[model samples]
Target chain A: MPITRRRLLTAGGGLALAGATAAACGSNTGRGGGGSGGSLSHWYHQYGEPGTEQAVRRYAAAYKKTRISVQWRPGGNFDQQTAAALLSGSGPDVFEVNGPTLDQILGGQVVDLTDLLKDVKDDFQQAVLAPKTHDGRIWGIPQTVDTQLLYYRKSLLDKAGVRPPRTLDELVDAARRLTDRRTKGLFLGNDGGAGVLGATPLHAAGLSPVTADGKVGFDDPAAARTLAKIRKLYEDKALLLGAPADWSDPSAFVQGLTAMQWSGLWALPQITKALGDDVGVLPFPADGPAGKPAVPVGAYAAAVSARSDRKAEAKAYVRWLWVEQTGYQEDFALSYGLHLPARTSLARKADRLRQGPAAEASRFAAEHGHADPLLWTVASKVAYQDALSRIIKDGADPEGQLKAVVRTTEAELARVRKRS
Target chain B: MPPAALRPLTSNTTRRQRNRTLWFWVFVGPFAVGLALFTYVPLGWSVFLSFFDAHNTVTPTDFTGFGNYRRILSDPEFRSSLTTFAVFTAIIVPATFALSLALALAVNRLRWAQAFFRSVFFLPTACSYVVAALVWKMSIFNGVRFGLANTVLGWFGAEPVAWLATTQPPWYWLVIGTVRLWLQTGFYMILFLAGLQRIPVRLYEAAALDGARPGWQTFRHITFPALRATSVAVALLLVINAFQAFDEFFNLLSDARGYPPYARPPLVYLYYTALGQGQDLGLGSAGAVVLALVIAVVTVVQARWSGLGRKEE
Candidate 1:
């Protein structure tokens, strides 16, 4: 008999031994189905909200014809565990990826969902489409989009007599103005985003981290200028180093820890609840002569397992859930949490997203949002972050840092080619 | 009489020996099964996987002998991680031993409520490593001005320090190091306490009668030599635990997104390579195999130095 996901999970192997307690705690392993023609398995990372799990199970249950087993894995180890399952030949038939990576595509682990997506393909925002497309084939169906931008306190900026920053220079000036013994201005992350926004600044400089053609594209001198600017901000005491929490939670912003914070759209509701009409959002300030304001848009997309024997069935389920059923998709996005549905028409219908800063953020995400290339490996990503750390924090030469990053990225691209 | 002669001397011995063999396996069965399944099997698989180029991580179809090992051996990050772990081990082992030994000595001489003091110290040992690390990361050593460490420092006319973020001054090491020391020292103290109790009261009496002092001289001559086996065992345990450090580093040193490479030990580095954004299992396994080898060599040297396996009279 072929090894099924259940046998591999329940048999107490390595994953079972390691993550079994986490699995037993929140996972819905008993979702009433196996791989019959209408049966499929799906997996999701843990969402902290109370009802998110039930919402997913309810969505899966609506398709009475198909028996879909949903596994809500705990967050930290989800990616690793999913990779292990996929490699073990016992992966979920249909699953979600944060974004399409080159390894998934080259491993042939994900199927091209484009053929079935023709009907509703155009309705997806540009932010959702660019990252999922590799070699002109759409690897995943964008479920909902997540965008990170600057959330500023209007009261604090007004008190400092500073207008909302529109450029990198303006941001630095505003940050210094807002800085005092009481509060700092901006909080990117705990590590000053040494790893997080290393490539994002490149995006703001009208540069992408790397090209899909296997060339280093973020080596521009403008990126160096951006790094230098960040260092100046650091020297001015315009940044918060450590907070009680990371940037993902709205607590830092809500608790008045900083004048402004860089965070995702998911935290919008909590921030709004704490300080009504006091909060405003802006895309990361553009840099360089060629630069434009931008938001880095990432999404969890639904894709079929290429190795699944029921690839056709899995593809149909993916289409039915993410594309065909707009109501469930809308509910999946808006009802559970503050997320923009992948479909443009659906996002337009979200009342909370239709007005004020929400509308502006939505528009900015669609227009200025950038996607990571499929071929960029995790090692290259870490290298980019390290390069930024060396340049901005350690005062190392920017050109040298870029060259080191370039060398590693080229090796990663070569590795992809060899694997493919 | 002819049948008895034909049966020979082997018949009874064979039956008895077979029964004893069967009983031996029966008694040791669960332990053997658990060891094979959890420990040895994964080890064998990791060694096997080190020879293959695996993408999915589980199924290794491509046989590239020694390629994975060669890749990890040359990687600068892997080498840096080893050096970091070496420093971490050096600090933790002696520190843990000294703290535990001191606590054990004090508790051994206690005239009343000895159990209370012992229980209080050992409470943290019973706490989970992840939970303890998180408590330290969030409550005590958090980078805010109001955090426990910073609050105390502020009273001294010093500005609040970013205890976890000051990488240049290496303040983060104190955060990670102190939490580990607090969590583990108590358990080792218990071991030392057991060893302390085993020393004969008559020996101390005799040393005193011979004009030996009640403090340093007596401890050096009597207590120290008497706990040799326990000290060796404790040191070995400390070395192994230090090398395998993961839970504390991961929980304390990482942000919500992921860990920075500033203070990762070998296990955490291998985890990222294998399971973190890049699922390069072959390379990760190779790194693991190499780490296991390092740990094994260190353990063997330590054991030999301590005379761990030698027969004691």
Candidate 2:
């Protein structure tokens, strides 16, 4: 039909009304929808796995005590978004955190979940709880555990006649020998070795980023020596400088862009699907006799906002979903992406994780896994990463850079100490 | 006091005046309130936050006067960001100005299909900077061998280059510069086209009558002199925009790992300072205030140099 002005205006108004109604309904998710216990809002960073969003939504739907709406945030900057949201007081009533931040602990942003997990606290590992605990109070319940280690191709290493690296020096030499026109020897990340290797070398050197006294521990000569070795690897052009995908994903390794890649255990499913029996796993190599190999533990946890009006309901949901609901937890961890269940009992029972590369990765994690110290604030990490970038990418003096980063870390630690 | 008929007319006039005044406020009231609420209020809040140690929270009780400013000013990373902004502006402003003027001049000389060419050239202006930057990063300048740039390089028997690597060779500048130029030049060209249309045809005819050539001499004398105001305005815009460059820089450079230290503009640095993992809003706000002041001073200096508001003499 030929449109007239009145008809057009009427249609536009109708569409606007519909849009307004839909938006009102969407925003009302946080409020009760005939539920007696009220409603809660929960946020999760968009997981890369296919079925994670549907799974979380399903779990939220299953909770009978309170109605919950899931807001799946997509982007690499979920932390920044969450920080802004919490500061504005419009944040989710329940949310996911990789580890409880210092501000979250000291500023009273996160509710203490210690009492919620009191009965089953023993099921969770101490290493997993260390980052979430502040002053002996657990701020979050562990949702899933991820471990980062090196993934190499068995076939490629055999062809090159290079065994798995057992030390930092040997790792660098292997990277050089394995590099060719077709592929690079190693992939630490697109930013040379700045990001994925930031804490790895420190762990390999038997050093913590922040010491028990809240002082910088990475400025020691051992840390500097390890970083310099990585720099030499970078200068040899044996490490992958830039790839379409970063080290977090196994795309660089599976696609033959790099022979060996530093990645997480979550990528194992995809790597095995692509490379079949050709893949192998190893922890980051040791730097010297004083040092031991280490696999860094990365995890996600669930927490309730202290300012949430539905704190009781939110805590109930966290307890129900993350703590009590083992079946859902196992599915959430294993179904979409391959990850270790937060509970040691669940991990021990999983048949898929009992053999092959998965078994080896779990063994390494159990033996040599390291998590960031309580005092390792984001400021210190940023400073250390910046220095690492300069050293590896720009060939800056590692000793001088580490010294400067120590000053920055010390200042950050002082702030944390003052706040606490 | 004068007459009965005159008094009624006076009342009618008063009523009309009242109606107009009511309508005036009705038109402008929401806009005024919106400006105050969204722009001015936040600006004032930012300045206030800069004076306090507002980390992770907007409402901070701890006041530290000039400490945030001093910290940001002393920061070498912040200082280098300023230099990055300077380098970006120095390259982009001139490059955009010349390219847009050239496009406008070429489009003006077209006898047929002028509208088609104009629309075609101006289409990219409608694209979002974030989307454009992504296309440039992922498809064109990606480091993989199958990327568009590398594919073309491979045709010429050259090794694939990591275009975004900030180590030794700064090919990232080329990638960033080209994307901005493509996105911005079309809009400026439209502005220049408007200026070109307003230029009196009689002047060109007069120059021709005075035995002037049609190509370079005519353009150098007549066209260049006439576009002074347009050039100044476009240059002013380009300079301000160059300072506010964030979307492309942030999206193109920032990865899951975090932003690289190199090629960080002032806005990106301030964004990281205020909002990134550290959550130092006070220092970020201070950096923001400093950046705004710098932009203002530069705009004023350029406006004065170009004699923007002075009567043409």
Candidate 3:
């Protein structure tokens, strides 16, 4: 308490050193509970929309059986953080993932939820459960169903005297026709549309890239043509290049940067709020001769870590939150941003998906939504991504690229099969 | 009396020596621990991991024995990513060096407002690479009609260009490379300025007296030679820094899950392999080890070429 020079210097130096350490190490005061009082800890990647963190906390607070601590980690490097945490055996008891990869399931990191799924198996949509169900044992319970599709400006198309394209060739032409001094027609995504391009063609062709077996589904000549046809859109300058937002964000479409954009169902409410009746939705139009209009369907699944100390409690929490608690599931799906409930019964009954693009999106997702095969590996995906980028953006031969992809895909499939 | 005095002196000397030894360990301990924990340990573990097929868990299962290294080398994406990084460094290093040197020379000569100008130039260094990337991507070079670059293009009767999205003509390189230049030039400029100030005033006066002109002559005869060591160090740093390029490329040119082939650098490629959907820690660790070796070799080559350790008379 003395105001001496020695005391002042000591205090100041100590405070400065402490501040520097905190800055360098980035305050380890994370939000998740550190097992104080033996509470259950859950982790979620930070959602962009407001009230999501609070909503999760509100759910955790409702559970009086145990104190549940939740950490809403900042997005961007969530995968790295989650993986590192899980690897160290200090990860959350319960967490959510886009879906369990073959690696996660094979690594024995995720616990099987077959017991929870035994009765409620048919209640969930099959497409949503495709990734979660591997080796005939369900690993994760479905959390939210997200599907990607094209959101178009009906008014802009009408003014330009263009109908929504039903085929890849038509899409190319329509994109070119819709182009003017003011607007370019389509935006699949900023990175030469590679985000959607790799999967959409397969989806449109009514084929998954890799089947349950290792057979190549996207090796069709028409699929090759579809890849090549995208070149026309690029060559003609019909595609809008870079926008601030990615495909997940509806900002580009709402702002009228492009007349039509490939976006997700999660953006339905946001797009409707922004553009109202001017918006219309369609699947990634058929790319191959035998294809149908299709969309890429994805979902986040609640998984209990095998390494969790409270594995049983974590499973119970997951079951209660994602399965038994139907009301919370609906709220989680629709109230914040639009995502169809994983439950088929609840999804169809939800009022938001009862009409318009919401209804259409849900219907299409149920009927035609394509999930990337559970066995798909990063190498195989990259092979397709590179092939697609080259064919569309760099004027490479599509058939040749597809063949190259087939070779790589087969190799990767073999590697994973042997390893897993 | 002499014996008493000698013992006291010896004890005092011994205490001073002991204090110095204690201080040395105290100061070096934290840094030594940090280096081993974060850097050396990780590197060693990574080398160990390169031999096996690891997944989500750091603990590897299969003993692949250089399989990851062989596989990655054969993988076209990894090879191309390395090439892309090489090209990126080639373009960025020279542009940054020249611009920084010019700016430094200009700042060093200022009789007044030198601090103001230096601060203005150095302001960009204060901004986060990711934040700067977003600004560049969203506002300045965004494909929209009202973007700053587009607005300028429109004035010149050119169509608004989708800078980051374009891959055919490699226009995206222009956008990404420029942001790298803008974000980095300031820090390097400060270095050059420091180097400039260290140059003896007599050298410049000597050059001036020897009929060395103001523009190039002064720089060629005096400034450039005096800053040779600094230039070599800056160049070496530039290459290493360029190889670690991630934040700008990642933020500016990537989608939800991965970067396009054109935008992929070696580190990003490794990330995709290691952690992206498949979560192959083995391949990623192998890639990282290989990359570290590459960086080490490049640094050594540069240091040797620049005569880094050779004593200059």
Candidate 4:
């Protein structure tokens, strides 16, 4: 028998109603049981190639006693998925939150993790924990920490007859000498926005856009100087216009088209895959006359949904995956060969990371890195992007653009504060 | 004599009429309820929300009366978005209409394997927008040398163009328009083909017998009035889709934050305002309400201009 639209509608409505009723009744089949140790649902962003799925299932099987079911959803537009789930109160119990938006998510409905990780909190990197904490209340546990590093094609550098730059002046001179009309010494597409523009340069210059107090601190003279250097690079044709910071893939460095690419440690695997053993990693050049090289520190956070009824189980699962068994570090190395453990202790203990180039880069990034603290605000992302676009597309003055961004951000912060 | 003069009233006719009316209502009732629940109810809610400062995320707190609408009126971003939206609609609507009509006419002339040809044309409409966008972004319209479009361009001695990365506005618009055409033209073509079939062949034959050429005949009668209704429907649909253009732009462009100069369609901006950055539900809802009104007005204007609702005399 052919189904009519009316019949379909009736069936759908009836099913939805029944589902709602069942949900309200706290159906044990789907819903996690907290203290009784039933099934726990853990959602994570997908990673690795084809073999990664097998590794994840193996990891899940190893931790079967936790009764946790790991559902790895591919990481593309995760915010939309999370938002929809949050509204319907059916979001994953445990999920990933970006470093910058850590506080905002926490403020909304994120479960507090202060008491949950009281004993083990200090064991993790302070930088990782900083963004996840608000008013001394821990809202999330760090899963992985990332930091920006300069990726160079060793063969390209050698072919160009230039050594890696040790100082800012030396770097500029090297870039100038190395650059030709067909190829650039450095490739950055900062036209997309401020985050892309600011991330590498600000870190290299030893400046932070946001301070510990969640205030706008991006208007530093050092930041201006860095922007000036970028402008000079563009003027000299030392940087590729084709690979605008907004749209250019960092993989250009791996593809041997560019001499240097400034990105995070995550690109190591990709670079390794593309260029094989011909890539060399280095920290971005130091800003001051005699400062150490620096990179921007970024962390991925894991948090329990505020709407989740199985908060305890979710927290327990996070502790297990991220803290207890060193599962996160293992997964990071074995699965994607991308991430570094957020916990310093775990990084030291993980044999897989210690034996690879990823470990070396992670350790370098961690010791000398800056993290953006203005992540909790909406204006930061937009303002950052707009500032970059203005600078690249309209040839707007960097100082003026940065100041505008700060002004806009300050106003947004005030508005949000007032609303609260 | 009085009983004979008084004719017996037939109850069967009245009973049959009552049954037909009941059946008609039964069919209409489901749709009426659906319309009330999904359309009118949400629309009413949206209009109500527009009066206050309503956010789309968290719990909407502030209730500044007409604050959102006033802000929207003065906002440069909103003005730019409206302009962008208008340009996008204007380009896509007429281009899609002409292309679909041409395709329909071509397909209608085919005798052998008509169904296969029709299916081939409509295949893109069935593909998910996400899949299509990804494929277009990665493979076909790839900005790099590896892309199919660039490979074809290479044959003509042209360098690979960064379709997504270029600061050039016209190129960006062209790329977006091409994708939209690829996805939407097929569905509209089928609609036009159906309308073409409904056009009486006798009229064309009569026009031909009158010594009128094929193109002239089509221009005079067969093509003009026959496509009027389909054009109106397609125009309205295109306008609605243009305003609601999010999935392709969002997926293909922008980062995790959904920031500007990429996918920041007004709806995307509204979405970001609500969920991405501010978590402000009020501003987003207010933006949505404004967008709805804009779409409604545009669609109504098009429908009126096209004489979509006018009955044949």
Q: Largest DockQ belongs to which candidate?
A: 2
**Residue pairs whose backbone atoms clash in candidate 1:** none
Tens-digit lDDT track for model 3 on A25-55? 7744342334545677788988877777888
- Native-to-model Cα distance after best TM-score fit, residue B178 in candidate 2, in Å: 0.7
* TM-scores of all predicted structures: 0.91, 0.94, 0.93, 0.82
True-contact fraction in model 1 equals 0.51
DockQ of each: 0.52, 0.65, 0.64, 0.28
**How many clashes would you count in candidate 1?**
0
Q: lDDT per model, in order?
A: 0.82, 0.87, 0.82, 0.68
* Full candidate order by DockQ, most accurate first: 2, 3, 1, 4
TM-score of chain B of 3: 0.92
Candidate 3 residue-wise lDDT, B1-313, digit = tens:
4775566566788898898887676557667878999999988898898898887778776788988899888877788889999889989999999999889888888999999999999999889999999999999999878889999999999998888777667888888888988888989999999998888888878878888888887777778898998899899889989988998998887766667778788888887777676678888888898898899898988899899978877
DockQ of 2: 0.65
TM-score of 2: 0.94
After superposition, candidate 2 runs with Cα above 4 Å error: A1-37, B1-9
Model 3 misplaced regions, further than 4 Å: A1-36, B1-9, B201-214
lDDT per residue, candidate 4, B1-313, as tens digits?
A: 4684376657896698788887676667667877998999876766666665443334445567888778767766667777777777778888998899899988999999999999999999998888888777767765555578878988898866667655544466766788889998999999999988888888888878887788755665767676777777887777778878888876566654355454357876676765663555555667788887777787788777877779966
Shift of residue B82 alpha carbon in model 4, Å: 1.8
CA RMSD per model (angstroms): 6.0, 3.4, 3.5, 5.4
The lowest-lDDT stretch of 10 consecutive residues in candidate 3 chain A is A27-36
Each candidate's chain B TM-score? 0.92, 0.95, 0.92, 0.83
Query: For model 1, what is the C-alpha lDDT against the true structure?
Result: 0.82
